[model samples]
Target: MTRALVIVDIQNDYFPGGAFPLVEPEAAAANAAEVLGAFRAAGEPVVHIQHVSADPEATFMRRGSHGDEIHELVAPAAGEIVLQKAHPNSFLGTHLESTLRDLGADEVVVLGMMSSMCVDATVRAASDLGFDVTVVHDACAAPDLEFGGTSIPGGAVHAAFMAALSDSYATVVPAARLAQTH
Candidate 1:
């Protein structure tokens, strides 16, 4: 079965010095680049998913803005599939499902920004769409949050999301293992 790596929402705004940056964005980008390199070296397919915020009030990823573009560290190669999405779920309101179907992919390994949001959304959507989804835990991150006067660490949210996706929604895996897979 053909396998594809879905790098979702590694956009400029999610990185440092952007409108809204996630925790450890640079490291996530670097890990994703490593994974992408491994996939390319093995002649595997990669789909770069971008999230464009339809609302200008959105802190980051506003459509038609530079922040919505994919990060420079991991630029899309010529002929690489680029799916633009308006929602947190890449498969919703986008051609992502059709693209994967066209590519004849059976498995999808997901890695990218906003671990608790977009990453989680994509994983669930992929699973519901019947693809064998494996989410790269270390290659995903989310912004810190505050609840009831307490600050929630990004790492905690990231871990929680990974845990949630592990058994039912999708298989949670590390980038190293993903690199070893087809």
Candidate 2:
């Protein structure tokens, strides 16, 4: 069971002082850093995914912008792979799947910003692609969402999405678990 860590869109835009900041981004990023450290210490594969929008009118993560850069918390080290993606699903129009395969990974460990979007999409796609998936719940963040005139708090949104993903998509666990096992 070879394993790889996929850091999905932990970019500056999701952090404080950037576009589209999410709730508890620093806390989630700290957790993600810990998991990333574990993977590095164990000599496992790590792939950093950056969301770069090509649309000129996009409010955030515009290509070549600072917001599109991956946060320093889990920045790709020299020799590590960094994949730029235009969509929430990391595998779409990206070399993520092929890269993982090339790295001999059969299982994927994912953690990053916006639990309700990229994290959700990437987890589902990984599952569909037949890779065993594990999501670090505490290592992911989410922004508050509104639906039908109801405002959903970011915490609630994150929990709801994690719950949904845990039910069928992946085995969701806290960052500490991976740290211990790593």
Candidate 3:
């Protein structure tokens, strides 16, 4: 079975000094880049998913904004697929499903920013689409969340989401472990 890598929303807006910053984004990006290199070296298909918000009041990822641009860390190189999406679920209204199918990929390794949002959404969607999904836990990050006036730390949020997705949605592993195999 063919395998592909789907990088979701590793944009400037999630990094420091951008619209909405996440915790340890640089570290996450670095690990994600390592995974990208692994896929490239193996000559596997890669899909870079860029999210652009249609919401006018959106704080980040607005069209034509530098913050909305995919960051240089794992920027797309020639021949790598780059797709723009408008939703947290990368496959929604995008060519993601067809692209993976066209590449004959039965498995997809995912890693990206905002672990609780895009990463979680895309992993579940990919699984529902009948693809084997593996998410690099260390290559993902999450933001602090608030609920019922209670604030959750980013690290805790990241851990919680990763835990939630580990067995049900995808087999979650750290970038280091993936590096050894790739």
Candidates' RMSD to native: 1.3, 0.6, 0.9
lDDT of each: 0.88, 0.95, 0.93
Measured against the true structure, the TM-scores of the candidates, in listed sequence, are 0.94, 0.99, 0.97
Q: What is the C-alpha lDDT profile of model 1 across 1-182, one tens digit per residue?
A: 78899999999998778888889999888888889999899988899998887886887788888899999878999989888888889988988888888889988989998898889888998998899988888888899988899999998888888888996988877778877764
Q: For candidate 3, which ten residues in a row score worst on lDDT?
A: 173-182
Error of 1 at 29 (Å): 0.9
Per-residue alpha-carbon lDDT of candidate 2 for residues 1-182, written as tens digits (9 for 90 to 100): 99999999999999889999999999999999999999999999999999999999999999999999989989899999999998889999999999999999999999997899999999999999999999999999999999999999999999999999999999999999989996
Q: Which stretches of candidate 3 lie over 4 Å from their true place?
A: none
Q: Is candidate 2 or candidate 3 better by TM-score?
A: 2
Who is ahead in lDDT, 2 or 3? 2
User: What does candidate 3's lDDT look like per residue over 1-182, in tens digits?
Assistant: 79999999999999989999999999999999999998899898999999998788888999989999999999999989999998889999999999999999999999998899999999999999999999999999999999999999999999999999986889999998987886
Clashing pairs in 2: none
- Alpha-carbon lDDT of model 1: 0.88
Model 3 per-residue lDDT at 14: 95
